[model samples]
Structures are given as C-alpha cells and as structure tokens.
Target: MRRESGRIPRRSFALLVLVLGTLTATGPLATDLYLPAFPDIARELDAPQAQIQLTLTAIMLGLSLGQLVIGPLSDAVGRRRPLLVGFALFTVASFACALVPSAPALVALRFVQGVAGASGAVIARAVVRDVFEGDEAARFFSRLMLVTGLAPLLGPVLGAQLLRFGPWQVSFVLLGAVSLVSLVVVFFALPETLPGSVRRPFRVVSLARTVWSLVRDVRFVGPALTLGLAFAMMFTYVSSFSFVSQSQFGASQQAFALMFGINTAGLMAGTQVNGFLIGRVDTSRRLAAGLCGALLAVGVLGALALGGVSGPWALVALTSVFCVMMFSVGFVLPNATTLAISSQSPAVAGTASALMGSLQFALGGGLSSLAGWTASGEASLASMAVVMGSVGLLAGGVFAVSARWAVRPAS
Candidate 1:
C-alpha cells in the first residue's frame, strides 16, 4: 500500500480525485445538510430538544463504530466492495429515514445512515494512503479536503432552501438521491486501490494488536488525539450552532444559513492554504502553529461569550471565533493524519486509518453530546465555548509534548 511507482495517469488521477472527494463529502452531507431542519423535526416528532440533539449524537456514534469494522474489512478484502455495499446501505437508510413516523425511528435510521456513510469517508483516506505517502499524502488530503469542505459550506443553505419548498423529509430524500449518484460513480469509476498481494487477513487478534500498536506509538497517538480534540471543538459549534444563531442571536433561518456558509468559507480557505504550505513549511511546524492559533481563538471566544455581550457585536465576535477555529482545524487535520498514517505499516493502512477515524468521531460524538446537554433549552454558548477553549489548549500542549519525545516514522 506504499506509494505506487511513478505518477498515476492523468485521466485516472482526475477520476480518483473527483470520486474520492465526493465520497469524502458524504459525512458532511449527512450531518450538515439537515441541520436547519432540527426545529421542524423536534416539532413534528413531538420530541424534546435534548432528544433531538441526541439524534445527532446517535449518528456520530454510528459513524465512529462503523469505521472500526469497515476499515478492517476493507483491509481483509478490498476497497471497492465495501464502498459499494456501504453506499447501497446508506441509500436505503436515507430513504427510510425520510419515511420514518417517529423521532426514535428517525434517530435509528440516521444511525444506520451514518454507518453506511462511514464507508466512503473511511475508504477515501485509506485509498489516499494506498496511493501516496508522506508529504505527498498530506498534500493530497489537503486537496481532498478542499473538495470535501464545500459540502459544509453549501449544505445548510441547501437544507434551508429545501425546507422553504417542502417538509424536512425533503432533505433526507435529497441525501438518498445524492448517495445513489455516489453509488453509480463508485461502482463504475473506483478501482481496488489495495491489491491482493498486500491485503491482510481480518483476524480479531491481529486487529487488536495493530490498534494497540498505534495507541502505544506516541508520535501517532498524540497527533491523532490532537486531531480528534480539534474536531471536537469544531463539532461543538456544528452541533450547537442552530440554537446559538437562532436562540441566542435571534437570527432567521436564512440569515443563519448565510452565516453558516460564511464561517465555512473560512474553513475552505484554510484547506487551500494548507495545501500550499505542505512542502514549503514543515508539516509539524504548521500543525503546531495551527493548534496555537486555535487555542487563542477559542480562548477569546470563551472570554467574550462569558463576558455577557449582546447584539450584532456578539454575533460578529462569535463568527470570527468560529472562522479562526475552523481555519486552524483545516491546517491541523490533514497534517496530523499524514503524520499518523505515515507511522504505520502500509500493510495496515486501512486499520490505522480506521482507528484514527473511529477515535475522532468517538471523541467528537462524546464532546458534541456534552455540548448539547450543557446548552439544552438555555442555548448558552459560553459553557460550550469554555470547553472548546480548554480542548484547544490541551491539544496544543499535546502536540508540543509529543514532538519532543515521540518516535518519527521511517523515511
């Protein structure tokens, strides 16, 4: 699963990037595209606010657990099969979600959708590592994020527009239709990036050993955890933003969509900058700088939020904090993933990628749920902001400490 000899052919290269980028976007589509519908869902299903938030938690948990199984299965078998199977399952789950009668049923279906969606997200990264290594992999991931980031930028706006013409169910129907398209593309265009010669057996003992090995490696573990916590901070906002914008700031749905898009634009810009800085500046230095920036951004956000500010100034300050936090994440994630994956055996790229993805969402899901609970009814951003600030500072500390004592991957 090391870098393939010579460059991929131009047509094949374009095809890979296009398909993988779309595939990488499924998770965002699943989460972000339906965000504006939360209030509608709560009303229609007769569910409490906490329960609606828990639905989001369910999906995150499903995504976290799904990668743990799918990654290893891809390692045992091949990338294409799992992708096709997962897409099919995702399509069905999404369609079912639109038809579910109760909040609990919808939550259950969303969990299945997340599990099915995990295939694309997990495999896209595995395929990248399958084809490239080291800084090249980092650059490719940043480029991939450039494509993937667009989903978040446009998803909420898309959802809001859908809600204007129809019910919230329309969003799920749209998810199904888009996934059907992804299925066709994967089936026709994606190749088995992991060839038979290098594929590993899917043994429980072996999987455990590989995971444990990654955990024991300080270089991999530190950046991996840093990536997770950074994402958790971002997800804190993602999970809480609807309430924050609407309840705390008194924004209309359209205004909220516009604001969400603006902040996501910051994230998109950061990915492009990350791609540029990949080889020019060392990835480690860039990662450390990103974490430091995130720490500062979240700290300021927490301070302003707790200081009891109000009006447009408060809204502007919050959006600024979010943009900076997202910018930092865009820089940190790809570099951390590149470093962690580079440390593992190519034979176990799928397993390693799976562990990283699983830990990220698992941590993210827990943190998101915590934010949701703390912000319930009251819709207080201050508590969540403080938690995010703490996480940002901790992630920075971890990166600094790991760089001093951690083992570097083999060149």
Candidate 2:
C-alpha cells in the first residue's frame, strides 16, 4: 500500500519489522531445527538414508511451489489473508508430520508443510517492498537479517536438547506449536500491506505474463538469480554437513550442533556489519565485493580438501571460512532482492517476489538433491567441501556477469 508520501507510521513500521523477522526465521528454523535428529529419524522410521533425505527435498519443493502460487495470490487478494492462511496450514501440517507413522507419509506431510510455510518467506520481503524503497528497503531487510539469522544459531541447540530429552518427533510438534502462535499473532496484529488499488487481477494469463516479463527482464533476472545461487550454496552445505561431521570427523550430534551455532554466529556478525554499511557503499559494489570474498574462501577450502587435509581441525578451519563467507551473504541477499523488486510495478510486487523466492528454493532443492545423490559417508567431507566451493564459484560468476550487464555506465 502507498502510505501517504510512502512513509510508514512508526508503530506500523515497528510491527512490520517484527512480523517480517518472525516470518523470515520460521522457514529456516522449521527446516534446520531437527537437523541433529536426522540419523535418529532414519533409524526410527526404518528408512534408508536416501529416503530420509527425501523429506528435505519435499519441503524445499513445497516451498518453491507454494511461493509461486501464494505470492501472486497475495497480489490479487491481500498480504494478511494469504499469510494467515499459510500459517494455519503450516501449523496443521506440523502436527500431521509429528503424527505420521511412516517415512513416506512424513515426507508427504512435510511437502504440505513447506507449501504452507512459503507465505512468510515470500510475503515478508514483498511487504518490505510494499512499504519501503531504495535505502529504506535495504535497512529493513538488514533488520530482518538480525532476527532471521538468530533462528539458525538457536534452532540447532534447541533441537539438540529436544532430541536429548525426547523423541525426534518432539521437534515437529514444537514447530507446529510455533506456527500456531505465529498464526495467532499475525491474525490479530498484521495489517494488509497491499492496498486494493494496486491489487492485480487474478487471471492465469496475467500471472504467466508477469512471470514471463520477469524472466526476460535483465534487471529482475540478474539479481534474482544471484540471490538464488547464494542460497544454493547454503543449501548444499546444510544438506551435506551431517554426513561430513558424523562420518568423516566423528563428531556427535551435540558437537555438530555446537559447531553449527558458531557458523550462525558468523552470519549474524556479517549481517550486522552489512546493515551498517548498506547506506555508505553502492549496493552493486557491496554485492560484488561479498561475492568475490566468498569465492576466494571457498576456493581455498576446496584446495585444502583436495590436498588430503581431512582432519577435524581442517574441517573446522574450512567451516569457519565458510561461516565468514556466510556473513558476506548479508551484503548480497538484501541488495539483490531490493534491486529485483525495485523495477516492478506495485501491482506485480507479489508476483515478482514469488518468482524470486521460487527461483531460490528451486536452486536450493536441485543442489541439495545433487549433493544427496553424490555423497557418501566415506567421501562426505571432500564432497561437501567441493559442492560448497563449486556453488560459491558459480555464484561469483553469476554476480560478475550480472553486474557487468546491469550496472549503468558512468557519466
């Protein structure tokens, strides 16, 4: 909605920040909180490792697909309604997942859960665009990072403790409860950020046209793909880390959780620094610099892995570099997102945001699947390192090309 002069009221702005932060954090926490329980899930469900891995894929697929639908629907209808509906579905699906008796059933439920959970991930960003532009949007996104980044750091620890005291199913139950709480809070508190005047018609051809235009637009495609590739790097690591830590490094689940927390801490630090620098540096330069740093770190880590340095400390060192690269993500993600949405009409913001989200999760899902197919406990460390490094390199290339094509010529 266009606020009078496009400025949000202070109270509305504060609430927007809280809602966006909560929504952004929920998807990651849901996906990651039970990571330490993966081994146990396989054992309890009497499923093979590959079957257990499908649950993750299902969630990712649902997330991408849901956003494709939900984002456009939000544009046609409104933000608050879609969010409430998605949260309600997510809450129910969480309970369904907790109660599922078989691995296949659980996978199916997780897919449904992901679809429902997509609202927050897609709409939160769109809502920011709805309310703010340029530097203000960048600042809002950074604030979002403050809360979203904390979830990963905290989720693993919480998951570890829950696994220690109870069955792995407890994690799903807890997620369901959290979704319910979020639903209630949003139902009462979240305003309809998308005003009716700017709402697009809900026609199939119109939606397809919006997507086609976005795909063809250099401005949208470049930043959107950059964000997607950046996310793919993280997904590759998340998908493979457990096997590497447990099989290669001989770390317990608790140990892995601790290490994961450290990496998230690095991400938080990066987000904070990026927040401070958003207004000072040009967004394009900031993204280019961050991408370069990530590329270098990942390259070095890959070299170490290739050189037969497979010890625990080596893993830790490489992981720390990965974490530092993660911090630089703050520089890239928000800026790319802001750029992607900036050129679109307000009528199509939801569709544009949806496409961006869909592309990101699609990249993530594809990479995670590839990692699962190629990984083995014996070669887990090297494989994970290679995957992360390769994704980083690919992302860097994408950003460089996008920058060259998209950046304006100097006066």
Candidate 3:
C-alpha cells in the first residue's frame, strides 16, 4: 500500500518504526542470542574451537548469500510474502537447531536459520527507502537503530541468564519461539510496501544486470563498502568479546554479559545522538566525524592490547574503547546506509538494499571467522584490535573518497 507523500503521520510513523525496527533486529537476535552458549556448545558437541567458530561463519555465509536472492525476489514479488516465508523458515530452522545432536548438523541448521533471518534486515531497509529519502531517511534509520540496538544489548545477558537454568539447547528453542512471534507480527502488522506499479520483473538475467549496474555505480559502491567494513569491525568485537573477557581477563559469563550490554548501550546512545543530529548536520559530515572517532578508538585499542595490559582496570579500559568503537559504528552505519540506498530508484531498492546487506554480512562473517581461527586458546586481543583498526581506517578512506563524488538524495 502507498504511504502519503512527504512526512508520515505520527501514528503510522510509530507503527512502521515498531514493525520495521523489530524486523531489523532479527539479525542480531539470531546471532547474539546464542553467543553465550558458544563455549557450552563446543563442549557438548566435542567440537574444536575453529569448528565451533565456523558455525558463526556458516550463518553469516547464509545471511550474505540469502540476501543476494531474497532482495531481488522482494523487488519482483513485493515485501510481505518473502518476509512471511523467510520468518517461517527461520522458526523451523531454529527448532531443528535445538534438536541437532552434532556440530555439523547444528552448523547446517544455523546456516539455514541465518538465511531465513536475513530477509528481515534486507527487507526492512528496502521498506524504509520505499517510504523515505535524504536526511529524513537517515533520521528514520537512526531511530530504527535505537530499537534494533536492544537486540544486541540484551541478547547476551538473556542467553547467560537462560544458561543458569538449562542447557544451551534451550537458547535455540527460545530463538524458535521468538521467530514465531516475529512471524505472527509480520503476518498481521506488515502490509506490502512494494506496489505493483513499481515492481521490477523477476528474471535472473535482468537481476544480474541490475546488480552489475549497482556494482559499477561508485555512488552506491563506496558507502556500501564503508557500511560493510563498519559492520566487520562490530562483528569482530562480537566474535571475540566472550573469549576475550573470559579467557583473557577472567570474567565470568555474567560479567561478560554486563560488558556486552555496556558496549551495545554505547551503540544505542550513538544512534539516538544521530537521530537528533541528522537534521542539523549533513550526512557526509556526520559520517566523516564518526569515522574519525572510530579510527582514534581502534588505534588506542590496538596499542593497549599490544602493551599487555592486565587486571580489572585493564578490562574496564578496554571495554571503554570498545564502547567508543560501537558508538562510532552507530553514527557511521545509518548515514552510510542512507548514502548508499538513497542513490537507487525505488524499482531497484530491494536489489540495492540486498547488495549492501550481502556485502556487510559477508565482510562481517569473514572477519569474525578469521578472528576465531587465528586466536589461540587465550584471546588474541592485539591481533583482533589491529584487524579492527585497519578496517576502520579503510572504511574511513572509502567514505572520504565517496562523499566527494557520490550523489546526494534530494532534500
């Protein structure tokens, strides 16, 4: 259904935000909700560290690959149907994940779950672009980030709390139930955002050419890469933190959860700040500033890790740096996404959004896997920090170049 042109009314605005933001939260909810169970899953399945970590990688692969297909399908058919089907798949896969008796089986199921979960994030972004543009779009995304941030903030703590009473399998069961709720909500609350008049024809060759067009559009490619790299930095932290806190600093599961919450809180705060600032500052300027902050934070983080700092104070300091990194991500991501998707026409919003999401998840998953595989028994904070810092620097560089030549959305 078509929304009114210009500003959406308050009631509709509130409802759209609630539904889209919840959909956007699915990625983190799927990934982070089970993280506290990682160690336990490893032991229970008799899997090697790398193999266990591969489960994370596998899901990321699913998410990345799934978006490549789902985005175009959404563009062709409309948003609501793909979303319903995807969530149903996620729910079923989550239940299967709970019943899996081996690491390989669990990994396979998680991959399917990731593929299913990805529809929410990709489609949610496309839906936002379907209805908004320019600074308004950035503002909407920032506000959406405020809601999406809750997933990461509470996911680990909830997982840790659940572990207090039951085996890690319960976490998967819970995930299945959450997906069921999401499925019900989407079926009831979400109307088809893509109208028939603007829908792209579904064809493989046509979709490939459309994707290739986006690939060559420096206007789209630059910020897309920036967003991807920014996500890579965040996922690196997500992948390493539990090990880093527990193995390196002797933090218990609960303590690690607290630290995770603190970092996500920083991310949420940044998104809120962006929501306020998007009208006052240009999106490019805001992006540049956020990248600068990230560069500085990651630099300090690397130095501290390499210095071999230890103790509770050291953990506190490290967490503080990570918080800064997350805050920077909050600023960079929404703005970068605005820059990327706003350049595309509505006809290809799904394809454009899909391409961007695919790149982000691919980079994030790849980096997380590398971090897991390279680290020894103890956490390799120095190496992870260096990797994160280097990516932060590269993302900043990409944005600087892109902002100079990129097309701006109409105000």
Per-residue lDDT tens digits for candidate 2, residues 199-312, read 888999988888999998878898899889888877777766766677667788888888888888877777677778877898788878777777776777677777877665
Worst 10 residues of 2 by lDDT: 372-381
Q: Show where candidate 1 strays beyond 4 Å.
A: 1-11, 375-378, 407-411
Please, what are the lDDT tens digits per residue for candidate 1 over residues 1-411? 243622344446666778998998988888988888888888999998778877777888888899999999999998999999999999999989888889889889888887888898888888887788788788888888888888999999999999999999999899999999999999887777787888999999998998888898897898888888888888888888887788877877877788889889888888789889877999998888788878888878878877887887777778888888888888888898898888876678888888889888888888766665563454468867866877777778888888877744541
User: lDDT for every model?
Assistant: 0.84, 0.81, 0.86
Greater-lDDT candidate between 2 and 3:
3
Worst 10 residues of 1 by lDDT: 1-10
lDDT tens per residue, model 3, 252-362: 888889889999999999988988997788888888888888889989988898789897698899889999988988899998899899999889999999999999999
> Which whole-number lDDT from 0 to 100 does residue 373 have in model 3?
49
> What TM-score fits each model?
0.95, 0.95, 0.96
Q: Which regions of candidate 3 are displaced past 4 Å?
A: 1-10, 373-379, 407-411
Candidate 1, residue 180: how far the Cα is off, in Å:
0.7
